[model samples]
Target: MAYISYLDLPKHWGLERGDRVLLTSDIMQLMFTTMRNGERFDRDAFLDAILGVIGEEGTLLIPTFNWDFCHGVAFDYHKTPCKTGALGGFALSRPDFRRTQHPLYSFAVAGKDQQLLCDMQNVSSFGVDSPFGYLEKNHGKNVIIGIHYTDCFTFVHHCEEVCGVDTYRFSKTFTGQYIDAEGQESTRSYSMLVRSYELYEATDLTLIGEKMERAGVAHVIVLNEIPYRIVDLTAAAPVICDDIKNNSSRGICKHKLQ
Candidate 1:
């Protein structure tokens, strides 16, 4: 039986020292491979390895977004679970982690930038103050594990907002009860730049992901049969924004309106 060491993650995942990264992972897929050879995957150990690579100066963020508030259920920052996956929910329980208050697209952050991220309570999910916006402002890296680009490349929405691509999205408000970290409950309204899911067919984004890879802004790697991508938001956003602004069909939206 072979053993896996947390120390090996930096080289295996192409993680750099002092890097700020937003991690999005499919834990089930990662566990299937990493837990093989009579070994088990330790969530805490894995997180520690990631932190070790980034060091004291770096920041780590995990998306703990849930859309329950949009469905009329109250959003309790302490109670609402992340629909995204296991890692995000796990991060939320850590004493050192700080959770943002965006309701629909909140993030749980650890490391030096935790307080800065915690202060970002954007009323709109994709607006300038959202986590997506903050990531671009900080020139952070996006690490995606065992998931397709279409499912996790939320920065595209930030690019859309930067480019003012409002043709595909509209501002919609959801009002509901919200409980803050201190247990203060209040009725509030939050806005979302919702895509016209019913009127438009989903565009395949694999092509753009490939394009970013070729452009050198995104690095693609496959380890133990699970695919991963690391992209620099500072470099990739401009290219993506240009593609969206120039091309009528950038492979992410329906060419014809319904």
Candidate 2:
């Protein structure tokens, strides 16, 4: 009775072509439940679907937020289960491969153990360790198939204005492993920062568009609005729509085009 099985996603997302895509369980649940009222897609099933769509070379980009994984005492730890938030399930479950920390931006990526192809971070006045950073790394390679979301990229914008930090810093902790400076077995942290997300929509899109251009990503698909089939990010074109009758006052139900 999972949402993925219940909803006709293969048809809706135009998966017939078998394109590569990046999706989170949170986004899958939201898209399925909002589009249909049946069983939801479980975590395993959703992951399977993404793998099936992307194939071997196709990459599935996911964000592992530093706030969720960090146990350090410097920041406020929410301690909520990974699946509770928007991208919580994917962020929590994936393996920690690469991490970067700074005063403003901080995040990590689930490693190859979790089957991630590309992972990177950025540091800015705003939190730069973001999904967008992931997008930038693989930009112009047509390396990205899809950028799915449960919640829009809103936190990145909020963190910069509120946190007032310069670099977003992150690290992966070792439980049992140890290493020494003289090429001996030891444990340490790996960190870096690529860029930041300022509070400018146009600037943000411009960067996103340039990355998408490099990656050969022709479409930026979103599930919420239904006015246009596709949008050209570079042109800043508006999605044109036809006027429809509002019959809520009457008993006549109408099916509107999305």
Candidate 3:
């Protein structure tokens, strides 16, 4: 029960240089964590510590997902705000971080692969062409802060979509006005695998993480008394997609489907 300094993060979190990390966090859960080496926590300092450890060779992506575009609302790539959390807004506020282009599921990206991530123009929100797919193929990790990943692993939908899970989800498209970096506007469309009400209530991705930890692909780590899960998307996607394909429970849902 001790306050941990930012410099000690690598030892506890296993963050290394040249790594690619996609993070989703609940920053409110960190409000009480002002004690950093007997001084108040500086958000920028925390980010610097992580980015410094990862170095310019690594990449950090913070989810800035805004669903307004999914509902036919216009999405401004430069102006629309983050609806996910404060961490995303913080990333958005940083000059070093650039936002991705997918309206419904964009991220604020920094470090080495920033341009590549910002350049992504995926047709489907969770398909192989999306950032989720990049994380899966590029040896990226899904990092969770202050919350259990089961509650926020949007990547699960990516697996279901790519695996063509027909029982519990269906592809749906939304069209809206999109404003790009050049200030040009155009009507564009995006697809997402919407959950089916006929199938099951909710997905249970606990098993996916369990399988990974058991196989030693990844593990949950704690830093400064906060639970953080940094699991390889490459490793976890297989477990999820396979279950989506053959699990009688219909892609690891809360209840079995008849």
Candidate 4:
């Protein structure tokens, strides 16, 4: 396998200037095909490639989610660590990037919206005030790398929450000790729309992703044997909301909550 430079990311990812993108990716694959000075994976080059294309106008959001807060553990703003993937850790290591405050669902944001995103008072993990909501307000793009949208796409929970789908899921609160960036500690409570697993089966989004693909909002591409799906959340949100509104059972989950 040959190497592709950072210059090739924009064309392959279908990025444009001033675009706000949410990246759910597996960056470890870079080790297989990319190397910086023959030492390790060219992760920095990967970020540089995306940033170069997005320019000063575009904003990049990488999920820095750590779920220890839900397990009654204290969340350290600076060191709780990202359980999602290598991309979040990489972004957190950069000086220009700033992380949002939601301990379970925070994001490492960069570019034009860095301050705007970091400034959010993350009171909820998936509410109107959450980073997910702000991104939806801006109609951001959901970019999946080395994975399929069905396998991920937590953004749909935002749709389900706003659209009101308590039939299958309901809002739940998790309170824990939160350690701030300034090293202050306090007890805090956050909300997430968790599944009613006892009533219905686990949420499956395979069908929903297919629906978006058919609606022409979700697109799939392959580069260097890695699969990528880019969903225009702005265009696809309506499709999901409509499905949930008309047929909640058919929208995301397989079984109807009883």
- Candidate topping TM-score: 1
lDDT of candidate 4 at residue 254, scale 0 to 100: 68
TM-scores for the candidates = 0.93, 0.39, 0.92, 0.92
- By TM-score, the better pick of 1 and 4 is 1
Regions more than 4 Å wrong, model 1: 1-7, 255-258
lDDT of all predictions: 0.81, 0.32, 0.80, 0.81
Root-mean-square deviation per candidate: 2.1, 13.4, 2.0, 2.4
| Residues 1-258 of candidate 2: C-alpha lDDT, one tens digit per residue | 333342334334444223333333345435455546545546555554544554444444343344322333232112222322344334445443232322123333332212332323232313233443333333311212224211333222322222332333223232222222133443333333223333111212333333333444335543433211222211211110001112210111112211
**TM-score of model number 3:** 0.92
**lDDT (tens digit, per residue) of candidate 3 on 63-148:** 99999987778999888899998888887888999999999899999999888888888989998889899999988877788787
User: Which candidate, 1 or 2, would have the higher TM-score against the true structure?
Assistant: 1
Output the better candidate (2/3) by TM-score: 3
* Candidate 1: tens digits of C-alpha lDDT, residues 205-248: 78778778888989887766667789998888877887787774
- lDDT string, candidate 4, 64-150, tens digits: 988889899999999999988888888999997889888889999989988888888867678778877877778788889887665
> What range of 10 consecutive residues in model 2 has the weakest lDDT sum?
236-245
> Over 4 Å off in model 3, which ranges?
35-37, 249-251, 255-258
Check candidate 3 and list the clashing pairs. Answer: none
